[model samples]
Target: MTVSGKTRHRFRCRYTSMPSPTSSLSSSYRNPGGSVSSSSLYHHASYLRRGKLVLGIMDFKWTLVFVITLLNLQPSSANGNGTVERKVHVGFIVDTQSWMGKIVDSCISMALSDLYLRNNHYRTKLVVHTRDFHGDPFLVLSQALSLLQSVELDALIVAESSGGVKILAGLGSRVKIPIISLFAAAPSLSFSQHPYWIRIGEDESSQAKGIATIVEEFRWRSVIFIYEDNDSAREFLPDLITSFEETDTRIALHIALLTSSTDGDIIDQLKKLMDLHTSVYVVHTSPILASRLFLNAKWLGMIGKEYAWITTSMITNFVNSMDPSVIEAMQGVVRFKPYVPSSKAVRRFEIRWSKNIDGNQNLQEIELNVCMVYGPMI
Candidate 1:
């Protein structure tokens, strides 16, 4: 049958009303497993509603379908005029075995998808190639060099932990490609020194102020600082001490834990802290280390209302995505997280992501930040 949008057509046949056929049409469109095409189903339903079709409502629905089909058939603007769209290759250096690495991977995929879906007019598309560095500086440098030599990358997104930032930043400068970091928030990697590096994660120094505010608001006179023994954590310690000092707060103790620290080391450190009278603690470390500390603290019966545990945003941002048992261990802990404005788009994306992308995991703030930074650039 021919489909036309003639405005003044009428039919003499009567069979049924429009609602039943419209519902059937919708069902058929939703589940199109049957041999009948949507167009045929619509026409048959319209004919069944009335022995002969009328022009008004039926024609309008058909016109809408046709328009949607036409839109779907239209080629992308970037591919017009027989011109090939340039593919911008971007490399990602991450610790694939780690939790932050997974978040970074998911966020990068979502960002690229959103960019193309929203801006179909762009003349370039990003192609991401990922390399895992296992959070080792030497491995990170080797990976960066390999990626630069093997691929014509336009940019590099490094999602390593704190210690590897400088090595990756140096590689970015030597290669003359911008290095974008979504998770590395070391204060030492300054823009003046590493002009090619861009960090999107909230600076630990700024978040230290938030921590100090929480301490002052709670009227805590002194707190024990527990942080990773790395450049990133050390870089923020001075600022945190300064912030606390500004608010008339004192650091009762400072303990640095190495990544290679064993359970005995953690427990021993906790024993030392417990020997003191300090009940207030501020932890600034990677989630892995934070998890270990909290788990050991919970085992030692140190996590309770009497002891106030505060964590920096580095730990807070990914708290929701952490293992539930680990979250339970730090039940009453106060966390300092950067404020992010609520967006319906982000909410919808999160829901979709939880349902389809990673069913077991919730979207984290760092993942959202990564998407926000990379989405616009694409």
Candidate 2:
């Protein structure tokens, strides 16, 4: 009852070396059957008056426990117990630094947001983990492997023309999950061969027919054909040839340029076509390369009233957003793309998409296969 500061210090030192301190805190200082309040962060002074001595310990330090709870105590991956929605993990690998990849990424995000907004009561959600390759096909393969190793993916999505479609599809087959391919124009994929691989778009056969039909309508006997020189492009040539043969239009000249062709390289190619008797030119390649070809053609005065320039859907989809000067360079150039109906939803998507990509002018409406973006979540 008369303990001084020195006496309190001695008692404190004696209690400091105990094997278990809970015993003294519960039994020696508290009420007869009362134990320490382990959950409460602080104890009231009234607890001491009633001889309860409610000692508050740091019971909130359960990071490991919370993690275990999230892993073991949560609901299944598909169904929730009326508390939280279950997650269906998805993996997306793309060249995000590229213009096309960035647009695809935006479309994927819009699809996911629209999906959950319409189905807020849905029990499952798709959680996407994205890896960017920045145009390197090898990086795409590595990223696919990394995602497969790190996540229990419900599905994995890749750009079909990204050059690793076969390897990624093989990975999906081994894991027994679906591999969704977007913008599939490479002509190498066969649905029958790879059961796990799902292609959202077709190769260039339909587009080729559309181009040939234009040639027939104009009564052009033959026209020059230009395409990117790559394995995929080479494989695509037979389709164009067959389509042109049907319309009795001959491919007078076929020129191939590397994907990395420069302004000088493109202008040189155009000059050759300009000197030719046939004035019609059908150019098919990736968007970037197509831009260079047409712009160079404009510079060489090959895109004027005398010459006819046509392009595939790949370039048309993003043509409206190209620098106005580039679009002007493409003046009188004809292109065929999947017709997208103008809806309020589509208009809003275009506006928001332009803002996201920081477009200087409005982008022309085009088709992105919604089925591919939405299927992974299901």
Q: After superposition, how far is residue 250 of candidate 1 from its true place, in Å?
A: 1.5
Error of 2 at 102 (Å): 0.9
Candidate with the greatest lDDT versus the true structure:
1
Task: For residues 134-178, write the lDDT of model 2, one tens digit per residue.
Answer: 787778788988998898777777864755776777777788877
Candidate 1 local lDDT, 82-130, one digit each (tens): 8656666778888867766766676667767877798888656567888
Task: Write down the worst ten-residue block by lDDT for model 1.
Answer: 9-18
Q: What residue pairs are clashing in model 2? A: none
lDDT of 2: 0.59
Q: List runs of model 1 lying over 4 Å from the truth.
A: 1-81, 321-324, 359-378
Determine which window of 10 residues in candidate 2 has minimal summed lDDT.
7-16
What does the lDDT read for residue 105 in candidate 2? 75
Cα TM-score of candidate 2: 0.71
